[model samples]
Target: MVLTPSSAPSRAPSYAAVLRTPHAACPFAAALLGRLSYGVAPLSLLLALKDATGSYSVAGVAMALFGAASVTLSPARAALIDRYGPRRVLPPMAGLYAALLTVIALATWNPGAPALLLGGLTMAAGACTPPLGPVMRALWSSLVPDRELLQRAYSLDGVAEELMYVTAPLLVGIVVTFTEPAAGVLAGAVLVFVGASALVSSPAVSRAHTARPPAGGPAGPRLHGIAALRHAVLVTAAVGLCLGALDLLVVAFTERLHQAAAVSWVLAALSAGSAVGGLAYGAVRWKSSSRVRLPVVAAALGAALLVAGVSPHLYALVAVVAVAGLFVAPALTTAYLIADESVDAARRTQAGAWVNTAFNAGSSGGTAVVGLLVDRLPIALCFGLAAAPALVCAAAVARAGARRPRTAGTGAAGRDAVSGA
Candidate 1:
């Protein structure tokens, strides 16, 4: 049952039809729960550290270390899942991650605990975190073999992720306000364990465990051999850089207005716009190649972000950001589709992980750069600087499109290679 575009029917399926397939619910729910925790954990960790240490610097350091550890370890963890399957990989790792978080929370509760110890614990927790996002993407490919339906599934996934991004912070905020920061962290731990357990136990995931590699071939492709994957990663990283800058810019904008509480609303508007855009993009079939679409959307995103950077008032900025956000998820969805179609079946999870890594790295770099600029320059300048990455991404995508036809062969072989041949 190796699925390919050639084998799927020509007619496109509705998203409702796709979701109605047997055994869809368990995996979808589990993936969503795990994703929510993924969104919630970072802020929870930061708040917990700040509560314990009474210094934003210490909290930032701990959070940065956690992110660094995850970025470094994600590819290796995803590779393991590809080789051994989620049933064997996810449950143990999820349990270990939860236990580590529990330990970090206990340490946070101990007011005298050293900051270094807490930072180390958070890093360890991040390293062991389950590769839920990559796994879920891989599962969708298996669940829906129709090319058109899969695109819709990915769009739905993107929309759900945006919702999580909007909701998780509020959830963390509520927990922190009512209970304690450590409770928020502990809540994330509980979600991770519960979600991972359900995902691993699902029949679909269990079947994926026995999924064999390409016949008479190895379990994965050589990374250096794939041009599409390399380009996809680069494009995705650039998008991430702009997003990182936007995150900080919003904070700076709210702080300058002395309405710090408004930051969440501004960010949520962006996510909401992305959610709407993703649904629309997924619903319609595109005649152009993904490579072409990638650059066009990236350029539009850069243009919109440039406008947001210069907005004169809080209301104006929020409106611009919302408009800018319409392009964000579509760009990412394009990147994921490029990666999915570029790699061999056995390497799909690994390819997705690489995309995630690029985004995280870009976001980290963007945040650091914007953080430095915020102290020295006007916030508008910082916003303009953020737009730089999106422009670079557009250029990179255009260059990749130019090179694709030359390096890719003609007819079936070339098409297969380009489309996960």
Candidate 2:
């Protein structure tokens, strides 16, 4: 099913056409809900922990533990999905994760609860959160086998992700306003459970499972050996670092302006820019290879951030930040494309999960690094530091693209040729 220059259409299929395909709706809706919860849960955790302990330090520690657990455990959980299929893996994990979240929410209300107990629950909950993003992306290959259409699907998913980020925080705010911070946690838990259950039940996802090989057959290459996958993970991690720094920078900048109330709008603007960019990128039929396009886009993103570093006013900062975010979803969607093309079908979920884990790790590290620098250095200098990782990502992508052969095709044949090398 590899689509070479000869096979691909002069114009890519419309996003609407891709969406109209049979069995597309269920997985999309389910994944959307699950991803929205994924967006909400961490902030909800922070708020809940802060409310319960009455100390931001304890809350930070709990969040750190939760993030660490997710980064540590995701690959193993994804491997389980790859081998046993989502039907068997997602449901049970989702249920356990939901239960843990509820327990954590209730514990947040107990004045006498120990810090150690709360931290453990947070970590466990993170460890158990379903690998919805990876699973859904993996399903796209089977659900829409056409390379061009699949690219469109990924782009649409990326745009949906931007919407989720924009909406989730608002949802959390509303929940926290009407109820307690712990109520936000409970709401996120419910979303995860219901969304994951519906997703796993979808026929598209059910049919997309890769069966385990017979016990005696040769296993696939070690994760490190898969150059495309490794590169995708590294590039994604770098992007995550940029995102993490930007998040803190926005907060610091807004706080400095004595307009903290504008933070949400500022962040929403960035997400909106990304959504627009992703839609545009997906709609066009690009003549260039993904390898070539990836670095170019990364460099553009870095340059935008560098300009943002020197912005003189809140309006200028917002403008540059939105411009920088324009490339975020496109770059990520391309990285996912690379991972999908780089690994064996049986190992795709694992590779996707590892990429996600790397991104999360980088974000956690970036936040810690940027938080320290926000007070110590000038705001502009902090932004320049944030742009550094994006530049590194560009360099890494350029190097990887140079090493790989040029391919107009990005299907089974293209992937097989790459993997075989």
Candidate 3:
């Protein structure tokens, strides 16, 4: 049976409803595992590379390259999901990721071409990039009958992400210190493969990918990619730009402190804050769009940036990082919700992918810009400059709010039907 939003009941699902089916739980569990494992690999690789080479710069280079690869390929990955089913794509990717980890481990053991090749392979295998985030979002959209539940789901996702950042690095550090970084990487590989494979095997995910029914009468019109891009979405995309900048600012902050070893801690602080914000936002019963949350988040982020820019002490810097992160997930959750509601259900995934793509691009671009600023100016100046994007984002949100109608489901249904086709 097709589950459309229009057919959903008015009442919220009771605790009994939540318990009656196991499907709702599957995506959340899968998300937890996938996020945890993914978090470990980067921490392990960075620590291992830096320890072996005694060069934080080299570690940065490795990370930059990995991010570059992922950013470059993310859209193509989404397109592939659009074409081939996610089920067919994720498992092999997991296996290949495991092989690459083994190669990296061997490379660390011997430090040679085989390891280098594997590292490069790992980067290129963006083709197999696990669809954990997208798939989870899809499952949430399907399983939850209420829009509020969907909002809560994304908020919970943000919280889980925060928890991963909080613990993954420490775990990676401990494992590497007691044994070896290679061991930690290997463990991450194992967890990723196991968890991702299990998620792919779940009935809900499999059905969502393959259950496209035959169309009656012209199949309507395919949603023009351009038409799918709404002004609200465009505004929220700018918030992503700020986040990208913030990610880089944190890295640059660690470098300026000459405590490059603790860069991940700064990142964790940001993630933790975001997770807290998401959880808190999710708990609230507001039905407003990004119109409501975007400004609040933007103001918080701007203030945090100001503090980070001016603070001279490391503890103060960390505090500002946490404060800055406080708004990140909330802003992002708002963006996702806006994008989801703005587009047609059929085009929902594409819209969601567009948001992800924008965020990734923003992050990479923001980091590169901040990194250059750090080289040319004071760290304070770099941190201060990061706020510019957030300010721009806030302006865009205000403009969109002014133009947008108060309710989403009015005349937009005709527009959405045209688009969703």
Candidate 4:
């Protein structure tokens, strides 16, 4: 009863056309609405937790556990969607998560909540958070069967996500200014509950067998989608590492210049560049395949960061960061595309989740790794060290290509590789 993808288009299509795919807008919009909570939830919880516990240390610990649970369980959650379909799995997960957020908000509403209780609640909420992003990407594969169109869809998705993160913080900021952080948490809960509800009820879910029969057999004897995906994961983790490190590094960079306010401007510039680059990357028809492009984009990101370490002025640093940002969304979008195209249908959500998990884990790791380095090494060298992973991944993928050319995917992934990444 699995619903297969539509036939590939005869030619490349635009982003608008990708959205025009039958029943796509409904589920896509719903998923984004649900995912926007992702942008809002973390900061809200941190602030709310801090208010209730009245201890920054306790709040930090709670947030750490929350993130740990979410990231660690993401692939597991996505696997459920791949089996049961989003309609069947997403609703219950979203409900449980939303309910937990409600409890946390109530506890934090007036402060004085026990630290133990707050931490446990936040972790529980995180555990039940639905795999909305992964589910949406899997849906995209079915909705737009063509690689080019799918690329545009993913690019548009990445851009939207980037904007969501930027905008969500501002929304939370306004809320906290007027009321309390718990209100922000309440808003996040409502968004997910409503979004998941609407998304699951969409005709898109009802019309198709979004679930695949359990993925059968190993991908191949050796080095196929599995190996290719491994490359993407490693490079993505590397990108995550640099980005995670950049946040703290930028702060340190600005501290030296005595202009702490510039941090926002620099980071904003980075986001702006990513949106622009993702859009640009999507519009052009590529002559090279993502298998070839992943390493290049990863390296380009790393190269930009390397150059960023030496920026001489605030404007120069912002420009360099924006340039580095250019590769961020495109690199991530390419990685997601790799994950989507590399696996069979049943494994699509899990595959995408793993890439996501890698990026987040790498970011956390980067933050920790750079924290230790800043004390021992010069700032410029720390930047170089942060850039090392992407450069190394690029080299490794090229070396592997020389030794063997792997087949892309098996069991219904029929698309060919296209253009440089």
Best by lDDT: 4
lDDT per residue as tens, model 1, 1-421: 1112334335667779768867776798898998888878888889889989988999988888899889989999998998888988899999999999989888886466788888889889989988898998888877776666777888888899889877898898898778878887888899999998998889998775466466226534443337667877887888889988889989988998898899888988888889988887777666555656777777788888889878888899889888888888888887777777777677778888998899889989988889889989987777888898788878876875667544334333223343333
Top TM-score model: 4
Clash pairs (backbone) in predicted model 3: 244-363
Candidate 2 clashes between residue pairs 3 or more apart in a chain or in different chains:
none
- Model 2: how far residue 225 lies from native, Å: 8.3
Give per-residue lDDT, candidate 2, residue 119. 90
Model 2: how far is 387 from its true place, Å? 0.7
Question: Which residue runs does candidate 2 get wrong by more than 4 Å?
Answer: 1-9, 210-225, 403-421
> Candidate 4 regions off by >4 Å?
1-11, 208-214, 217-223, 406-421
lDDT, each prediction? 0.80, 0.80, 0.64, 0.84
Which pairs clash in model 4? Answer: 286-419, 287-419, 288-418, 288-419, 288-420, 289-418, 293-421
Could you tell me which 10 consecutive residues in candidate 4 have the lowest summed lDDT?
Answer: 412-421
lDDT of 2 by residue, 120-150 (tens): 9998998897999998888886677676687
1 versus 3: better TM-score goes to = 1
lDDT score, residue 373, model 3? 77
- Which 10-residue span in candidate 1 carries the lowest summed lDDT? 1-10
Is candidate 2 or 3 superior in lDDT?
2
Per-candidate TM vs. native?
Answer: 0.91, 0.90, 0.79, 0.92
Query: What stretches of model 1 exceed 4 Å from their correct place?
Result: 1-11, 214-225, 257-260, 406-421
